[model samples]
Each structure stands twice: as structure tokens, then as C-alpha cells.
Target chain A: MFKDLDPLLHSQLRLAVMSLLIGLESAEFTFIKEKTNSTAGNLSVQLDKLSDAGYISVEKSFKGKKPLTTCRVTKKGLRAFEDYVTVLKQYINK
Target chain B: MESENQILSTEQSLEIITRMIRQAHGSAKRNSVYLIVWGVAIILANLGMFILIWVEYPRPYLVWLIAIPAWFATFYLSYKHRQEARVSSHLNRINSFLWYSYGVIIFTIVVFGFKINYQLNPIILLVSAVPAFVSGTIIKFRPLIFGGVLFWLFGIICFLIGGPWQYLVGAVAVATGHLVPGLLLRNKNDEQHVQGS
Candidate 1:
């Protein structure tokens, strides 16, 4: 039997965001937007979902009068990602 | 990408995974500024000291002061780099730690050079290899590995040369080890930038 895919990370945009965050210490909101090529409103909604799910931590601060938002995957998020990859590999191989 | 709410097949999911992971690898590119700056500085100091010593100057070591620019450049460029950085990665932290630790060790020896009173040529060269080799392996950059080899190989050779002539060997080691690899890294970063764009 195949393990279930993570619902929180199953969506295309959420998965993409998680994948990018997986390797970085932290990434700014603008960086994610550019990488994912998502509209600001859409990206913000997805980020909020991830934040609500406890899959990532978001920090809001000011950088010289500019509001900066940085996000990092939580330990819980890392575990979820790893498990997701394992299940993905099994699916791909089978 | 989520516009139509199309369901992903296994293949599409796999593709996303691969693409994102590859994107993550993009951070592997070295900043190169530090490497180039120190390489040029150390190379100049080594060659200048050797020449001064060859001419029987009272303070051949004073030539090392030429490296003052390298320190200034490091501070200025790193600050600028931090300002511009959009994201921080684990690789960046590792690189920072390795080089900063090596920097501390180098300065410590320079400070206590008088107490040791023995020739610094071999000691400095030998110690310098640790950071270069480890970083090369971590980044999988071969030029830096060769640079480390140059340091270790000629470091032992410096032992045989002895005296002021050791300065010459030090010059060669750093020229091949630091400067050459640094330039190669710079070129590599440029190529990666083109690809990324």
C-alpha cells in the first residue's frame, strides 16, 4: 500500500514554496514570489496557509523603511518534507 | 501555476521535486569575493616579502603591510553582500564558518609570531591547507583542492629551502593555491549567473 501524500504540501504552489525553503536558512517573501512567479495576493494566501499549518515560520521586520518578510521551514515542516519525499520516491519507482 | 486547479500526476509531482531541488543547488555558487581578495593580498605580501628579504632589507616582513587593503576590502564587500542578500542558506553559513575560523587562526599566529620565533613559512602554509581543502571538498570545487595540495606540498618544500628563501616558496604556494583557484571560482560564478539568468 502507498503512503498518503501530505495534503498541506500537495498543492503545486505550496510544494514549490516548501521545496525552495527546504534548502535555505531563510528566504524573503519577495524571493519566493519571484521564484514561484505567483501573484502577490496568491502567494500571500499560500504563505498564510503554510504558516497556519505550522509548516513554516514567518518573520516580519523593516529593512531601512521597507517591510521585509522572511520565512523558514520549521522542524516539523522539515520532517513533513522528508516523509513526503520518501512517499514520492516510492510512487515514482513503482 | 495553480490557476486552473489541475491535478498533478506522479510524473508532474516528480518533476516539481526535481526542479525545486535543482533550484536549491543554485546557492552552491561561491561568492568568490573573499577568495579573490585574500588571494591577491597574500600573493602580493608573499612576493614582496621575498623580494625585500633577497635585498637584505632590515624589515622584510614590512612588505606584508601591503595586505591592509585586503582586510578593508573584505569588510566593505561583506557588508555590501549582506545588504544585498535576499536569502540565507545553510551553505552560506558553512562557508562563513570555515573561512572565519581559518581567518582567526591566521591572525592568531601573526600576533604570536614573535613567541614562536621559528620560521613561519612552513607553519602558516601547513595550517592554511585545512580550510582550502575542506572547503574544496564541501563545494566540490577541484581548483581549491589543488590549491590546498599546493600549500601542503610546497609547505614541506619550504622546510627544506629554509630562511628568507622560504618566502619565495610561500609566494608560489599562495599564487597557485589561492589566486589561481580564486580566479577559477570567479569565472565559475560568472558562468552560473549566465545560466541562471
Candidate 2:
């Protein structure tokens, strides 16, 4: 049976973030933005959506007086990603 | 780099995954400085000790004071690297911790070994291998893995080579482990930057 694609992750920016975060233990907000080439306003919205869904966690703090925001993919997010990829493969391989 | 509204094809999603992973791997290594600095310092200390010993010079071991300058350079370059960086990866952090912590371990072994009246050449090499191998595995870099193995092999050989001559083995291991890899990584990064530009 074909598993359904994760609706939350099917979005382009969200998927991009998930792909990058999977390779890393954690990444900063700016790092994600730079890699994704997404504008601050839009990326923030997507991040909120993902964060609210329990797919990722956003931590805010200061880095030497400058505010630092870091993001990490959660365990649930990892499972969702893997399942999404597996479902994606079924489509791609056919 | 695409519109959010459009449905991505399966091939496109796969491509994104592959591309992003490659990009993550392509991020600036920042390890060239550590390798080059420590490599040069170790080589100088080893060869200087060898020469001093051969000439029957007093306080030949003081040549290791070169590390004082290396310590300074490490701090300066690290600050510079941090200033210039836009993003720092988890891999980069781990690599930094591995080498810097390994540095303290090596320094302690050398200084304390002197006080204890112990031969540290073999011991130092054995210790050096830990960081080299672990860092290599972390980055999936083969040269450093080979360098770690070289340290282990040379460490054993130091016992056979005997006395001041073990300094030669130490030098060779440093050259292989740090110097060679530093130069290669520098060149690789340079080439990558050029291609990127």
C-alpha cells in the first residue's frame, strides 16, 4: 500500500528545511535562511507552521549580545521525513 | 529556489535532497588552520629536538616552546574564522572540539611526562590518533583517517627506533597526519571556492 505524503512537509520551503536539518545535529535560523535563500518574513511563517505541528523546534537565545535563533528537526519530524521520502520514492520509481 | 504553490515532482524532491546534502558537505571546512598550525609546530619541535640531541645541546626539549606561538596563532585564526563565518555547522563544532581538546591532552602528556621522567613520544602518538581518526570519521575524510593510522603505526615504531631517533618518527607522523592533510584540504577548499565563484 502506498503511504500518503506528509502534508506539512509537502510544502517546498518546509521540505527544504527538513532535508538540510537531517544532515546536521542543529542549525541556526540564519543558516537555514542562507541555505534556503528564502526571505525572513516567509521563512518565519513556514518555521512557525512546522514548529506548531511538532515537526521542528525553534530555540531563541543570544549569541554575544546578538539574538540567535536555532532550529532542529524533532523525532516526529524525522519519522515524517523518512515516511515522506519512502512514499516519494514509490512515485519516483514508477 | 522555487515557488511554494507548485507541486514538486518526485524527481525534483529527490534532486533537492541530493543537492542540499552536497551543499552541506561543501560548507567551508575551517580545519585548514588547525592542521597547518599544529603540523608546522610539531615538525619544528620534533626536528629541533632531534638536532639539539645530536649536537648534545643543553635543554634540547625547550624547542617545544614553539607551541607557545602556535597557541597564539590558533586563538587569532579562530577568532578571525568566527568573524568571517556566516554559518557554523554541527560538524564544524565537533571537529573544533576534537582537535582543541586533543591539543590540551597532548600538551599535558608532554609537560607532565617530563616531570614524571617518562618517555612520551610513543604515548603522544597513540593519543594523537584518537582525534585524527574520530575527526576523519566525522567528516568522512580519508586522508586524516590514514594519518591517524600512521600515528598508531609510528607510535609503535618509536619504541623500536629508540631514544632521540623516535623524534624522527614523530616528525614523520606529524607530517603525514597534519601537514599533508592541511595542504590538501586548503587546496581542495580553494578549488571549491574557485568553482563556486
Candidate 3:
């Protein structure tokens, strides 16, 4: 029997973001947007959803005068990503 | 590139994960500036000290004061780099902590070990080898690994061959072990940039 995929990570952009953050200590908003090739608005919304779910932590700070938004994956997010990958492999192998 | 809520097929999901992880891995490019700066500084300081000693100057050790400016420059550059960097990796964090610890230990040694007489070269070189070896291993940079090994070899030689001549040995040690590897790393970084562009 195959396990169900995590709904939060099943989406394209969110999965991309999680995968990016999984190996990083942290990443800035612009970096995430650039790597994911998503619009700022869409990325922000998705990031907010991930933050709300406690899968990631977003910090807002200032670099000189410019505001910087940084995001990092949480332990929960890592677990979810690992589970998603395991289930994804299960589905693929079948 | 669809809607944020669009669920991907299993293959697409796997592809996205694999691609993003690859991107993340590539994002953390090694900046050769730290190695280059510190290498040049050490070389210059050793050379300066050797010259001062040869001239029979009363304040031969004062030549090390040149390191103060080098330290300031390193700190400034590091701060600037941190500000400009978009992403931070676990490898970078670990490397930073390792170097920071090295800095603290070196500072303590310089300040307190002054009570001893001309026994610093071997100990300093020995201590320096750890960061170079560990960093090279972590980054998979062979030149740096070899450089670290040279530092160890030179440290032993410095211990066996004593007196004012030790300054010259220090300079040679740094030239081969630190400066040369640093220059090679800079060249590597330049080539990477050209290829990337």
C-alpha cells in the first residue's frame, strides 16, 4: 500500500521552495523567487502558507535601509519533505 | 509554472525536488577572497619580520603591526559579503564557525604566549593546519588539503631548525602552503565566473 503525499508539498512551487530550503541554512525572498522562477506575489502567498503551517520560518529584517526577507525550513518541514520523497518513491516504484 | 495550488504529477514533483536541490548545491560558490587575503597577509608579515630582523632593528616584532590593517580589511570585506549574499548554506555556517574559533585561539596565543621566547612559529603553523585541512576536505579542494599538509610539515621543520632563521622558514611555509593555494583558488574562481557568464 502506498502512502498519501503531503498535500502541502504536492504542489509544484511549494515543493520547489521546500527542496531549495531543505539543503540551505537560509535563503532570501529574492533568491527563492529567482530559483523557483515564480512571480513575487505568488511566491509570497505560498511562503505565507508554508509559514502558517509551521513548515518554514520567515524572518523580516533590514539590510542597511532595504528590507530583507529570509526563509528557512523547520524540522517539521524537513520531516514532511522526507516523507513526501519516500511516498513519491513508493508511487514511482509501483 | 502553473497556479500555486496546482498539484504536480509524481514525476514532475520528483523533478522539481531534484532540480531545486541541484540549484541549491550550486548556489553556494566558494569565495576565494578570505584565503587569498589571509595568505597574502601572513606572507607579507613574515617577510616584513624577516627584513626587520636582518636589519637588526630594535622593534623587529613591531612589523607584525601590519596585520592590524589586514585584519580590519578582512572584517570589512566579510561584512560586505554577508550583506550582499542572497543565500546561506550549512557548509558556510560551519566554515565560519571554524574560522571564528581559529581567530579567537590565535588571538589568545599571540596575547598570552608573548611571555615565552621565540617558540611561536611551530605552534602557530601547527594550529593553522587544522582549519586549512578541514576546510579543504569539506569543500573537496585538493590544493588546500595539500597546503594544510605542508603547513604541518613546515611546522615540524621550524621546530627542528630554530633561531632567527625560523622567520625565513615561516615565509617559505606560507608561500607554498597558503599563498600558492590561495592564488590557485582565485584563478579557479575567476574561471568559474567566466564560464558562468
Candidate 4:
């Protein structure tokens, strides 16, 4: 049986972000930017979108007086990822 | 002086807190799986060595060395998974520490088992200390640090006692150091999952 997932997360960059967050306890903004190869502006936009959808939580803090942004995946995000993969499996299987 | 103050509604605060908790839980779940797998593999390898020793096999110590490649394979798989999935640095740090601990254990065994002066066998206990210290410093896990300290003491005692007992001390120290912390993390992950659900 296929599970329903939010279509918003199906995009490549957003999916990449969710995938990364899904595997991490938390990730710094720079680390996510480096891994996804997304420009800061683009990543910020995508992160805001995910945060809006309640799929991620973004924490802004300071590391040694420098601003540090960290991201983590929510339960909703994990469920969405699982469902998305399940749906993708149908296409591959078909 | 009177100043205006804004208060967030309880509902809004709850929603935000819930989202944060979920995010933390999800990340914990993924990393926990990796730790559990590594833990089981380490325990099984030790069990195999124990069996070899029980059977009075020649050079039974060689069996413990199997963890070298096993750990390498685990790390490679983890790295590939991270690359494919794009796991974050927070998760990566935890995974890295776990694997690094494995590397330290393997190196210690190899060093004291073969290369180090036979007289310094007791120092092997202190070997586990490095990973323990790393775990404490990097992850802020006191248990791991405590476990490392215990191993250090055990190593010293084993050295004083002398003979094959050092081997047992080394094996037990390494095994517990990894196994206990792995299990604790696994349990914590499970609890988080349940709460999230």
C-alpha cells in the first residue's frame, strides 16, 4: 500500500535537505550547504519552506560569537520521506 | 518604566516545541540504527573469539582481529549511506565518533597483542581510554568516559596480575565500553521514537 506524502518535499534540493536531516541529529547550516551544494539563499528559502510545512526545525545561535544555523528533521519529515520512498518504489517496481 | 511585552500563546509554544522534539527524535532514530548494527557486529566478533579460546584453538587471539575489516566495512557502508542520503554533520559527528571508537579498540588490540613491549601489556587498559575521552569530549557522554576510566584501571590491575588475564581484561573492557554505550544510545533512540509516534 502506498502512503501519502507532501508534494512540497518531492523536489530535488528539498528532498536532499530532508534526506540529510533525516540522517542527522542536527546539522549546521554550512554543513548542509556544503552537502547539498545549494547556494545560501536557495537553502535558506528551502529551509524556510520546510519549516513552514512543519517538516524541519531551524535553530539559530552563535558559535564563538559567529551566527550558527542548524537544521533537524521532524517526525513529520521522516514520515514524509518514508512515504515518498514507498511511492517511488512503485514506479521502479512498475 | 513600563514596557510593552508580547507573550506567545501556549498553543503556539507547544507547536514549536513539538516540532523541535520531532526533529531531534528523527535524527536520533537514524543514528541509533547505525550504532546498534555496529554494536551487534562487535559483540558477535568478540563472541567468536571467545568460542575460539574456549575450544583451545592455537593463537585464539587472532580471532579478535576480525573486527579490523568488519569495522572498516561498517564505516564504508555508513559513509556511502551518508553520501547517498546526505546526512547532516550532527549525525555524522555521532557516527564518526562511534566508528572512531571502533578504530581505537582495534588499534589497541593489534598494538598490545603484537607490537608493544610484553611488559607494558597493562597499558592496554589505558588504550580504551582514548575513545572514552573522545566520546566524553565530543558527545558529552559521561558514561563512555567513565567506562574508559574503568578500563584504564582494569588494564593496570591486569598488568599487575600478569598472564592471560590481561587478554581477558582487554577484551571485557573494549566490549563493555562499546556495548554499554551503544545499548544506551539505542534505548534513548527508541524512547524518542515512541514519544514521537
DockQ values for all predictions? Answer: 0.65, 0.48, 0.84, 0.07
For all predicted structures, in order, the TM-scores are: 0.92, 0.85, 0.90, 0.48
Candidate 4: tens digits of C-alpha lDDT, residues B76-177: 876765544422445346646665765677566656654555444466456756656565445545556677787778777776786555555655765666
> Which of 1 and 3 is ahead in TM-score?
1
- Mark the 10 consecutive residues where model 4 chain A has the least summed lDDT: A2-11
Deviating ranges (above 4 Å) for candidate 1? B27-30, B189-197
Residue lDDT tens for model 1, B58-167: 98778788778888988898888788788887766787788899889988888889997957789999998988887777677888889998899998998888777787
Candidate with the larger lDDT of 3 and 4: 3
Model number with the top TM-score: 1
Per-residue lDDT of candidate 3, residues A35-84 (tens digit): 89999999999999999999999999998899999999999999989999
Residue range B139-197, candidate 2, lDDT tens digits: 66678889999999999998677878999889999999888977776776543431110
Sliding window of 10 residues with minimal summed lDDT for model 1 chain B: B188-197
User: What would the TM-score be for candidate 2 when compared with the true structure?
Assistant: 0.85
Q: How well does candidate 2 reproduce the true complex, by DockQ?
A: 0.48
Docking class of 4: incorrect
Give one digit per residue, the lDDT tens place, for model 3 in B1-197: 56766757899998999888877754223456777777788888888888887888898888788788889988898888877888888787787788899899888888887687657889888888888888777666677789889889999999998877777888888777767877777676532321110
Regions of candidate 4 where Cα sits further than 4 Å from its true position: A1-94, B1-57, B84-87, B90-115, B118-121, B189-197
User: Which tens-of-lDDT digit does each residue in A1-94 have in candidate 4?
Assistant: 6544346655556766776667556777877777566688888888899999989988887765778787888898778777776666564465
Comparing 2 and 4 on lDDT, the stronger one: 2
Candidate 3 to native Cα RMSD, angstroms = 3.0
Across all models, the iRMS values in order are 1.6, 2.0, 1.0, 15.1
